[model samples]
Target: MNDRLNLFQAARFGSPFGSPFGSPFGSPFGSPFDLAHQAGEYWLDAWQRSVLFMDAMRQRGDDHEEKLTQAAPHVLNFEFDVVMDGRDLARPVNYSLLRIHTPEGVVVDANRRPFIVFDPRAGHGPGIGGMKHDSEIGVVLRAGHPCYFVGFLPQPVHGQTIEDVCQAEARFIAKVAELHPDADGKPALIGNCQAGWQIMMTSALNPDLTGPLVLAGTPLSYWAGVRGKNPLRYLGGLLGGTWLTAFTGDLGCGIFDGANLVSNFESMNPANTWWKKEYKVYSEIDTEAERYLEFEKWWGNPVLLNAQEMQYIADNLFVGNRLSSGSIHDSAGRRIDLRNVKSPVVVFCSWGDDVTPPQQALGWVLDMYQDDDAMALSGQTIIYALHETIGHLGIFVSATVANKEHEEFTGAMDLIDVLPPGLYEAVFVEKTKDTVNAGLVDGNYVVRFERRFLDDVRALGGNDQEDERRFAAVARLSDVNLGLYRTFASPLVKAAINEQGAEWLRQLHPYRLRYKLFSSKSPLLFGIAGAAERVRAQRAPAKPDNVFTMLQEAWSRQVVGVLDQYRDLRDSAVERYFMNVYGSPVLQALVGLRADDGRVRQLGRDIARETVAASARAKLVEQAGVGGTPEAIIRALLYVLRAPELRAADERGYAMLRELRTHSEEGKVMSLAHFKDVVQQQAQILSWNEEAGFVALPLLLPPSSAEREHALDVVRQVAGAAGELEGEAAERMARIAAMFSAAVKLAG
Candidate 1:
């Protein structure tokens, strides 16, 4: 085998909870009957567990329905008051804009910028983003920001499309701004998963309406992913394109089931979906029930989408992969171009997230601009933070994630905005115990922006033009197949199914039935409650040493492994079939696929306009980069800060310092906006050409010792407020101090 293959084989599997039983083989001398005696005892213990397991399942089902019934009509995870109903809008939809009512003790700073969050409407109800106290809303509330939530009804308006939803969200944001007129700036937007793209589209359309944008686990560049991973991206092509999606929506008789979307997510990892998730719960039901049921409440409350909405997404987004390419246009002929958004964009995604991988989250950067210089020339500040091992859901909802990543993200919004237009990877910094002046820090962890380039993003995505062509061909085929299906099968299917029948079919879905069977209505589970009580009173769970218990675990693991193997084999077959069928040159030619698969078919038209505008902006960018003293001062501070190779606290300290100085007695004489403009422009110029920017510092600052001394003091006051400087940080500060001192001594 090749070296790579050997490496893969070795790394794929890890020792599982290491076999405590040691060997399957037992005492060789033991008689069959004696073993049978022990086995009988083990069987009784196992039987008791079975009774308890059944009882737990029934209670879970009961809880599911009870929660559903209580949450009827609208189920919200956080407390909020309807600020403005969507029905009041000229173009109405079954959505609402809510102003979250913070808990009594949770202090909210009315002057602070408002945060508007939108949860993904992909197959699940809203509130996962704010379901727990330790969530996005929770984090925002803790930070004293007035929070807002944009949520939708369970059923969509009869003919709602993605465009309509975007309009409503834009309206909601505008309303949020109106409500917070006293606030410092426009409301910041945080969109999770599918909502991530929705907000981006809205931002592009109404660039002036929103503030900083945070997209968590959002996939803008759908086609960008690593090979041998992100298998779900291939499913659309494997399933013969979105024709099946249309057919499925028709079968639902106008409303598509979100449960199917959830199922698709589950099918991606059968080991987790079929066994591990449930096994973990079953193994620790005593302490697991509340948490398991809490998550299930959100997972199980699948929402419905109008057939129009689903088709629009599947065709335009999944099949066409058009959002990142600027191929999607709204009804009014306004191109929904992402580059139009001027707001600072912060992307939070994890490398472990299979649903929306890092490549998909970041790949859009590489696709949208020709290079990093092109991006900066456009005057956009894009920051992306990557977590090492969190899953897709954890990116937004995990309490640990919220407390650290999201807290830091929200606190640094101002800092992100003040940053010069460029590309950066936000890296987390470890906190030292002895850091001084902790009062300025907003969160536990510090984050530093590490300058990066388009190359870095493209490297992760490995933009394979070959794969692009295949997907393009698939899109072409999807159009053909969808046309055929609508002409032939769509009418017949629609004619046969009614809303009533569709509801029945939905209820009968295995996904729904799993919970229904545990309801009090199920005859088989009538006595489970009583039996569970008895089992609970006389319970005796077998320990790990029990032979039968060991055997059961072994058997269960084998079954899960077999299911995983089948899943892998099936996925492999599907991928192979898709590639073979779509890989044909003839098929590609028929679809008019070009050398680069028309991946940037629209780039020629878009980039030319961008280039001319960028050219106009270039002169300004250069001047800003090389401006006099203010630019030099910021450059010097940034150089010292970065020299330590340590992550400093949030950029908030710097932005705040600028704000505070502007309002100070001395600051009253300075133009805050002009100062910020100078700082940002100078910082960018220095970053673009560090060596020259460094050389120009002394020329910009006064040659006198008193003035130089005063500048250094300000830098120390601002940078040190967030934390004490040590190690490389201290060294860099010392170098700056010495340089300023030398200037004065030499002058004399």
Candidate 2:
């Protein structure tokens, strides 16, 4: 065995197998082994390159610090006023009180429309949505809309419950509304990531205040995932449920470090965290590294949450899955039911987001509402968009995503608001320059979207109950464990902690300790400057195509693969162990001891019945002549079937229908009120048919333009053919031609 080991070692980096010089484990100044010499040389060269890279980074940091100090004089820094006096920094942005004061500000002189843009409070500091020229706030302001930001402080507010934070957001919205008495629409709410669900909860609780809501990269259904994939969903069960979170928060005397969350995110992609990101910086050290480091600085800085808040999130959201299940209730006995939210909900998720898998991000809709009928019964319009390959942060942070997904979404916000209360999928179809007509309102863009059915969303990721059931089991176990922990362990832990102990614990936190201790202020870093200069002067970077460099890259990849495999093994073992332990029938029986006293079940049944009744009433209204006439309906249906070549034509038709309906419902005096009402009612009825030309055109157009034109010609031919029939069918053909003429004029 010793001989074999010796031979292996020698083959790897000794004598003729190693490089002539600079080999990782070869003779100091002599030629290494010939056969595998390049491998040793590569390892040595990579090490040299890494040392030089570190030196470069230190120098760059020094330069950036100097530049930041110089630019401080020119930069305009804004201050925020904190509502709750806490250790954390919670500063609100100072914007014009009147909507008319800002370019994007819109105050419907008739009714104030309050708009809140809740930026994600992840590891990064606030202001991404409102920081730049072309941002969420900018977009809203450009449209003459009122905007408010929910910004948090650098530190967390002591004892701040997530509920308290939510309440504060609600108060802000209410205040904005009060300031503008005559706004036309309810306040439009936009939430990104962490803030997405936060706003959702606020909206669900105070449904009356919210209008259209956009939830980007927000994971409402946390436990929803596909097998083997979305390994992050299995983390809670793997880590012994929320016990570790409780322990950490206890150690900090109630503050749970946000750094831990950031760390978990980083761990998801070892390649990015350990190699790709840093290597990209080193490879493009002159410029790319600066931006990489700037982002890393924010990515590294994590915030804190109160123990109670973290505990609630873990039990109710992550593990318990109670939010979607309609089992969660606020302190005041108000059930935090997602189904109660009346406004249109826009869900933006991506397939590549491991942190918030597509399932976790959208599965809540399936969980809360069994089908489109249930969603319609609740008077909710839920539209979701699925991106093929953007990561969690990229969904909100990436410039490309901002330009495409966000831009298109903002433009279509009004269209989304008018969609009939039902479940629909927003599909973004790529369009070519040649396909775009010059007369269109939107500029030449490569993509356009159309609303689709829930089946399209289901097709993207199969909506199966079996995987969700496993998560449901996790949720059940979490409740029992949390109850036991609170009753038996929380008191003991709390008693052991004090202010000083909490401070010490925070200082000792793995994330905080690294930044606090290793910074330039640290005494040990006194010699870092001199050492960095020496390293910079002796820098030797590896050549991209060198045999030695290639070998080094291969070894690095192997190491990464091994690490990933080990992590997978560890995660698998942990999940299996916990699931087995917690999923035991004995434990389940103990947990089920406090099962609902039947009142909750009865109440749900009552609510469901009321919802069904209301839905039926709405359907009746739709069916009656009160909304529109039978002749008008036939006309609209024919127009929809015949006109298949228009751009954004379906949405435009829907918009026109919505406007007409709104005017008619308001009883507003207009010269063409009756005509508009008749046309809109017909449009609404036609919109219901999934097989309508407008509905199918977006999906069918790609086959071939000739085929599409042929389809359109066929519709016209059918109309002409219908003219040949006598009596009712002949009258229908005449109405169809009239409707087509009116629609074409409106579209034109």
Candidate 3:
């Protein structure tokens, strides 16, 4: 545990490694003379930190090598004793199936349900999902769910393929299901980043294997990104194609280093990568060492992917964006479609995540379904939640996020299943409890589903038809480049490189070399670790009031600012070159991609429209404005409670209305979907002419006096569901409630 010293505590901004404290609040230095007197101490402190910084760097590198060395081949970063290894699976892949061992005193109910989590295999090693106490696995286990993990080995099996991995995953889910016979549903699958798409593929091919699927910071539409931003998406087109991936793999003797992927990610944010990340650790080494080292343990452990696997992923998924287009096929030649997924999908994304922005995370909905009605008629529930600002890794491991978002989401999975089959935004609203609605809430917040449409996904800054054309062109170019490379370049590259040489080259990568050279094994950094130890005994962190401390922070900020500008400039140049090259109509036509990008989206719209038309004749007719008297009143009430912008959708209120509806002999068997439809119709009606809605209330109200009083009581309960409804909402709710009450008493 790192010490929590408030040396530089001011504005708190969290980094991936740790939420570092800001510069000191007020000046402690009384005068220039006073500051000058302590200058010698400041200089000493600076020198000490510099030495410690180098020593820590050496330790980080040494730690990286030591961890790899000590782990005699089977390195499960997770705290799990492998019960069912991938080697024992039906079609064994590089991945292993392990049951996460619950910590002592964390009594998990074995029969409740199993929660299987897959960490992203992008570049880093597995176990990040379980890296902290407050995490996806941790919350689920505490909530009494049996937990399982799908992790991969450092090295791939000789003939392993993605298809084999997906098949193996299905077998893993089957085993989990076999273990928990009493679970209400199948294992709830949680996939972070890269694992997200894999889970979707597994669930799509084997529909019976999964329950609800949670995809956190995962991009299904690989080409989906905002313009002038998310430059990582531009690399394929800028570099001509994924031919580089093949060339890289060939140089590595048919293996792709995960470190290379990690380096690419680091390059995206130079401010963090070049300066701020290390500076933070160096400045607060005494208090940040534990966290820095913990994160590094996983960060340093880069796994390997087979050359074929890399080629397939880069060609089919990344550059081609084939998943969204449904062009990718399984081993059985059946198309792997997102629409084929039987389980509900819960997509959680953050606006702050540049890697997998909200556009990339949720844009597939628009690519798959043409309109909201088509989505609603599919009988598949897709729920999405967007955060204001949390970075990619924060989605998986941030303590505050894990407790709030993951906690609420996991708690509501049962409710998610029972929800009407449609597109919904799973909204979490903070509980004010100012009103008498305490009985309605179980905790400090309430989770509700707001109806969403395909347009809502399109609004996230992706979905440009023209930009997708360029990506399609890149896919075509990639095939050509990869073919040429394999024919002309691969043999020579492979001949020159063996396993030993490839390993040596990978270790020589800049990211790895930085750590390797900083270690104590290097004579230049000799005795530094020992000197740091001696300095630690009389260590003194600079006072924030100190002028020198302020100057140091200012210098760091300036350096980071310059790096950020450079990153922006580099990204601009990259995007410009990619657009200019790939956006050429002649070039696109030559590559046979001129018509593809346009056709994919058009086909999606056509399928959705056709599905709606064909299914509508066979489907049940909607029951909006058709339910009996009680439903009319409840629907009217739903309209009023929608506040100004129609924000709050109280599940408890909906429950209360259903309970009340039972009092009268009307709408007893009405499904929630029918109720929702009625609510939407009524809201629309009220929006047209608010006074007309009030005047028309008498028709919906019961003629009998006793029933009129009963309806008013239900209205009161629904209105008060959120507790202490305030402002305009409370006033509107009261006015509407009174109108219905009056209409009921005076009904003809």
Candidate 4:
């Protein structure tokens, strides 16, 4: 027994292949016989788990094949009918628009603004937006809004381009609007991940066709990231630009496999991709199989992109980073400016999203506008919501987010629509005992829009001027290398590969091959299915307290720790390498990167528009003493909250305002669009001349003392909805109340 104990300790602590952290076995703590028994049990349980895991993989492969056999395959939890197929359109693409069937108990209001969810075709196929019950589509449907989904087929239409896809999406939006002419507003557009940027481009091209736009986990400013953190941004610099992209397309016979993009994503987190994910399922095979298979159903099934579409994305957006700069032009040379998107745009991003960090997700705002004033001048209401800790996929997939953030956004769509043109951050604060008017708040949190500025966005980590220069150099080099590849290599490569060979290569890709090898198709895995069933019937999982089980878990953790360290070191090295190579003066010169080119590139402001805006501001100042209760109440609220800080506008306040407008004698005639115009006009008046605007506030109020008192009461309720006004806000409120009272008394 003593000898056996010694040997076990030696193997655990002293072996060269022991845990990455030095073992802590200086003395024996358990009976040798008991330890041996537990170890034997653990091994048996592990063997069962391994068989079950193999069975799960086989099932995943079977599902993949089944999905391949279907037309417009998706993982949406609800039933949907195809409304419009892009393949049937004049400019055919592989996308389709589907109207989701409402759940059994839910009733969708056709008169409510419709919602259209556009899923990302990044690497995986579509349906993630509506993959679960508590998802984007689910929330909209539950709220009685008619929901539509835009998804793509696994294969692209031949000779398709990104331009064709955008045009098709615009047509779909128009069709949805036409279908719901009685709807209160245009259909709200929701884009997730890669789809977010795509919809933005489409909206820019056809602004009038879209309504409010919601972008979840989208990366628009691709090059924007903190140094030493986002190594993927350095990929272009490390690879010497997009020549390899062209090479891959040529090898695909003019089609690019999305599996390559999925592989790149998997490579980002080696520990999760290689071990943690599989190990978790293996350990919890009894409970986790369904979820694991469901997720794999989407991740493993990669769609295809036309080579032209891929090249356009790689050149103009990813490496070029020109979308936000308004550098991309249509076939007719029409500039695609984000400012052209007239509807309110809401961006939902997360700090924990390594794939699309807050910097990349929100950096486009900074690129397009120099300041808050510039954004407001464009008459665009842009709202961004930042999550404290959620990954890229969780921004759309996580049920918790769908129920809370999405629910609040949808519930307050009208409030957002009527917001004055400015930069605002959507903050969802949890309600507690301290929350005032908690009953009035929706859900578990108080959803509020806090005004923000360009500087706030800059505070989030992003590329400095030096980083910009390096990225600029990378883009220029990519163009040159792409030209060289097209001239010398593409033709030869294309000639060497045909459709049949390309299909073979795709089937043999490592990501796809693993699934095929584990499935029933592989003779080696033929017996795993039956074996797993037998094991499941007679399962005997080891206790968590078992010594061997504890040791196994420790070892797994150690492995993850080691891989994380490696990833950190690798990312740091890549960042340094990119900076050293691209920052070189010679390389910059070779790539035609000028010294002054480090400045953030944006479209030159339209002189004609600027003149109009200037005249409009002057006109607003002249009409500072505007007419009626709506303008007076709005102007009063604006005056109290005009400081350079975040101002909270809660749903309860908007609800009260909405009720007031509906029942009030004077406000009943004001339409939402007309009310929005009044709000903006009053806001501009205050912005131009604060003192004069404040003095003129009472002049806009009704002469009747009772009417003036009621208007003041409405303003107080709306302003105090967030909380009791404090400090400057409190003083401003007092002054406005006093001014209103004095004006009423003088009129009497």
Candidate 5:
């Protein structure tokens, strides 16, 4: 054995072998001895990484166990006191409303609008919204807003339903409003992922309860997605529409294990879930363990839901796609129309979010209104912002986003609340050295509201008529399958299992078993902690230039590439299969659907209401030449900045406007609501007839030369706060100035 080892080592290092083969290659790469030494170091480092990786797994399992022991098991990093418990409400649920204790050195304004963050209850436990210092709750608090959190327990209340939860949320909002009676506006509601639709429904039913609403990575139009890009939408049809969900719920004996949903999410990205995630931690075990373990504390602890809640979500929202279509109703049987939401809605979604793509986030606007005119006439202010590339969770939890997107959204809440009722795209651009009025800008970025049309939304991509028909067929078939199962299979399945048996099944689930198997209490991880400690004391991480480390990373990339390809192929095949099965005329006919008519469930137009709105707009247009300085200045500004492309604004300009409001005679007497009304009225007048609106602009201005000059100066200050007007904006501004000058000469 010694002689063989010697021979092998010598041949590899060119000691015993002839010099030509090893000597020639070794010059460009490295000396054989140098390579051998580096290889030995890599092996040692790999050994250390293995021990450290096992230790991280053990610590993660330990953390999961610790979380399970807590009564609420929330991941919120901030300390909070429970203001109201859902169990004490008329409609009991597992959720609770918490008032986040203001962090030291952070001063909160009592008169500012209070912020309530509603975290999603889809599969995972609550508190991802505030799990880190740079999170949704953190941003709200730092912005001097009174912050509140709506979180839930790991276990659901025994008889809780989705309706009960929605009711509970409404009550919570009312309580927040009542608590802050001196606040300038109603409480701003921030919803993440699943909570987005939930809050939207509650707001629709009780339209007056909320202020501006921020929905981050929310999916309202569940059935809307591109053809091959979204395969998760095809799952309902492939599984034959909600039957498996029903079966799984039945197997849980009235309780549904959220692990099932978590598993599905993991399946979406097998490369990340199974290999790359853990491998990255292993490769950088010295530094990555803490982050991996912290995230696992939330990701590993899947929360429970009552079977009824899951069924409603699957049947009504996921497969049925009823919410966006206005088919969902309250207990009073009133249709839950999205138009009923009185507050301005700011939707923040990402293009790279496969889970809740921009299509799903913004498609609801297309579903609710037929055109830009319909939306404007409905008196709903909708603003949507798109990120170039961010994943679903990153939309709310990422530190980078919290600093940029969430920060701007919250900072501009007051501005959004007073926006005229219409569709606008929120655009954010970086502040540069040459940016006009640089001192007026607040931060590294400037945010502006750009007017948009329905076509702008359609450009994001959505389903065709055939796709809608196919999804509708799936919805119809889902109802039939759910009914059949409830009648035939549910009773038998429920009878076979009780609560204790269900608990056993849940504990034995593959997702849960992995955590338990690697826990500190498990026999398998007996010596891992001590071994890891020893390795840590003698730690030696490999350098990036190490040959073995490079090979390891290369192998990992190849693995990920292969898995990604498999996912694409699988998704493509699944999409095609679904289209074929659900699009068949025979299947569609059986499911009581028709290809000739592509209209799925949608709210019919209320001609009477629209007629009343049109009349109101006409009356406003007839009086377009009315109002004094405020109306004229605002109208002139809107006219000059009327191009379809995005424009920029700063908070300082809004602040200046507010100061103007406080100092002026008309501003001191007018209320915020009245100001919004005036802005909207003037905007309508301009839309009706731009040329006539411009012709009547001087009529709206005061006859006194000084007053007219003051109003024009304010417009120039506010408009120029962004920068010197350019191109058409500059020409328009010049025209307005010329109009004012001519009006002044006549007055003289």
Candidate 6:
């Protein structure tokens, strides 16, 4: 019995490779009994330590709960007026106008066209877009655009279809347009997250209602991602397709809880959700936790969607990828064609966003257009901007991002308007103290945009025919399963559920249970009131060397790390398992799925034809005479391309230009009219470059070089001015100057 006990002790603490109890002296020659005793002592100490640690955690949890309850009133008191009754809260000020007030006292000028900001109805409530002065509404308002928020009611209107909500949004836009008959531009629409795609559908159906659109962190290309990167895309397959979504909705008796959506988002980053978010709050509980709790109050409070709506989203948008494929249609048989949108689309996405990655955000650009030529042929202008590292919500909600990215975009709205009907990428660059070309007239930051081929966008997200094939199979299976549910189970479920029962079920939901239990009514929580007050009073604040606190922090971090690794492992296993199961020939046969189908084949062909046509059209426009010949247009484009560089080197080029005096004497006069003509000609030749030259020439050229050396000197000084030439405009100006210098030398 003693030997057996010693053996058990040895196994508990020692490495598995060697037995310490056998020899009775550690190893072959050593006293294994001594080692076993030592091991036993270590384990006993560890067990005691673990017990104490757990007790500490229990006490900490109690304290945390107390602190939370104490702070709840201040943290959860959201100040916005929901009824539009014109009542001002101590926090959120209410307004009747279709405009949001900025902290800077800048009233956004509303256009007759009507601006609508559709906030994502995820787990959170309204005001993310206008939470700070540097937010989406703030940027729009600063630009003098009238803004209206498409906020939801605390409780959803009964029998609300997504279609009904869309119709209501359209009506709101129409009313705004009616109000502003004389506004300069049409109402610009901005949608964040889910709202982004909703607006797209709205615009598709009512094509004429919207003008420009900004879709921030919205995933249109749901199936897009690189390997190991977008694990969320693989989730539906692992969970036996979207049947779970349908099942949940059915169980809710026609209303699906939005908490599931929020929970899914949290699950993607266990580290952030489980530990980092709370730890950051605990570490700075005095101040930072207030904002954290405020956000959580909304995040934890989820809205409900009709089962039909949830099922529709799951089947069509998430799993099917039907929106981008043009496979989705309304009841009226009108295909939801994104290409029908006449206005420009600005897509803003980021690398750090796991929810709506750059691939999902921008991949649809590729999905919609075959090439840049097709984009121009369709008279569509798509501009996309990529951030290095901002999360999904941060793309629209973060104030710093809003001030920089959103502000720059809003400031350059007009530039985007006149950007010619083509695909382009907008890049925001910080200007140094030394950049000398002509276009940049602002601060340290300048937005530099370049015309990009659709192929470039496609390259960002690689083609995965295999994945698409798998998704198609999932779609087919979903349709089959949905049919089975409707034919078999749905009828019984619907007959059994009543309005009261549904409401009861929703109240009893796990997500809502905590909120209901904790709010003022529970008798069990009465003691919590006084306990919270005392805990707040006796709060032992953080210090650098508190060992217990340090251990707590370290343990918290370890827990988070373990959770993260577990999530990653789970994601990988699920993805692999699904790919193996769903990608099988047997499953494909069962579902009557084909890897390559007529729809995909037709889509490919359509893409090819569109690309060819667009290329030809762009080529025609590029070769079109500024006035007469193809060569002249080509020359004009070259001239415009080099204008900015030449302008910058004008001083250096002026020496050569001084040699052109003989030519100027010989009726080769450098007049403002000729310069203007050259710019206009260049603009017309390149089609898109036409505006660049037109805008550039007025700013680039002085009245004349009539005084030769004096004019040249003034031109050089103006050209050398710090803020004068910047961005693409500066580059174009320099190129023009270079071309002129070459032309002059040849003539000489």
Over the stretch 343-461, how does candidate 3's per-residue lDDT look in tens digits? 78999999888889888887777777776655655556788999889998889878888888888778777556544556779877787745345566554667877776677777777
Ranking of models by lDDT: 4, 5, 1, 3, 6, 2
* lDDT of every model, 2 decimals: 0.76, 0.58, 0.75, 0.86, 0.85, 0.61
Residue 682 of model 1, lDDT score: 65
Kindly list the per-residue Cα lDDT of model 6 for residues 1-748, writing each as its tens digit: 5543443443343344465533423453235554455445445434433333333333333432443344121111113322232122222211122344333556655543346677777655545676656678767666667666656544455565666566666665676667677765566788899989988888888877876888999999887887788988887777666777877777777778887888789889988876787566555555564466445545555666777778788888888888888787787787777887767799999989999988888877777766564566566778888888899878987888988888777766644544446666777667665555424434345665566776677677744776666767777787787778778887787778787887788777675565455544555444554554554565544333333344455667678879888988988887788678877877877898755554341233346546765675566453443232222322333343334332121222222233322223234643322332333334334555554433343222222333322333333343443345557656655655554444344434
Candidate 1 lDDT tens digits, 1-748: 3533433232222223332222233332133454575577677677776776677778768866775665333345667899877767777787788888988789998878899989799998767778888899988998899999888877787777788889999989998888878777678999999999999999999988988899999998877787667778888888778999999899899899998999999888889988888776666656676687778777877888988899999998888888888888899998888888988899999989999999989887876788767687666878999899999989987999998989988887767766667788887765656545444555676666777778877777644667778888888888988999999999999999998999998888888889898766799788988987887888766554544555566667777889989888887787787778888988888877765544433444576666766565565444643444345456667766665354433463575466334422243634433554665666555556656556556665665677667777777776666556788878877877777677768766
Q: On residues 1-748, what C-alpha lDDT tens digit does candidate 2 reach at each position?
A: 5543433443343344455533545544234454344555556555554554565455444533343234111111123333322222253221112222353234323243556777676655555565443556655555555556666654555566777777767776776667656665567788888889988899889988777898888988776666566777777776657877788888878777776777788787776776777776665554575566555444545556677778888877878767766778888998888877877898889888888877777877766755555555456777777889998877876767766677666666655654455565665545454442322334224233343545655665733543444455566666666667878998899998997988777667675554545445557455666665675576654445444444445566666778788767866775676557654656545546233222111114346657665665556433433322222332333444333332122333333333333323246633222443343334443444423423222322223444333333443443332123345544544555444444444444
The number of residue pairs in model 2 that clash at the backbone is 29
What range of 10 consecutive residues in model 2 has the weakest lDDT sum? 71-80
lDDT of 1: 0.76
Query: Model 4 Cα displacement at 380 (Å)?
Result: 1.8
Model 4 spans > 4 angstroms off: 1-29, 596-600, 643-646, 663-669
Give the winner by lDDT: 2 or 3.
Answer: 3
- The runs of at least 3 residues in candidate 2 whose Cα sits more than 4 Å from the true structure, single-residue gaps closed, are 1-115, 122-124, 128-147, 178-184, 436-438, 441-451, 454-469, 523-551, 578-590, 593-603, 606-612, 615-623, 627-735, 738-748
Q: Which model, 1 or 6, shows the larger TM-score?
A: 1
After TM-score superposition, what is the CA distance of residue 633 in candidate 2 from its true location, in Å? 8.2
Ranking by TM-score: 4, 5, 1, 3, 2, 6
RMSD of 5: 4.3
Consecutive 10-residue window with the lowest summed lDDT within model 4: 20-29
Range of the 10 consecutive residues with the lowest summed lDDT in candidate 5: 4-13
| Per-residue lDDT of model 4, residues 556-662, tens digit only | 88789899999999898998899899999899988787766648455677777689888887787679876777788888888877644426567878877875555
TM-score of 5: 0.94
Separately for all candidates shown, the number of backbone clashes (residues 3 or more apart, or on different chains) is: 2, 29, 3, 0, 0, 36
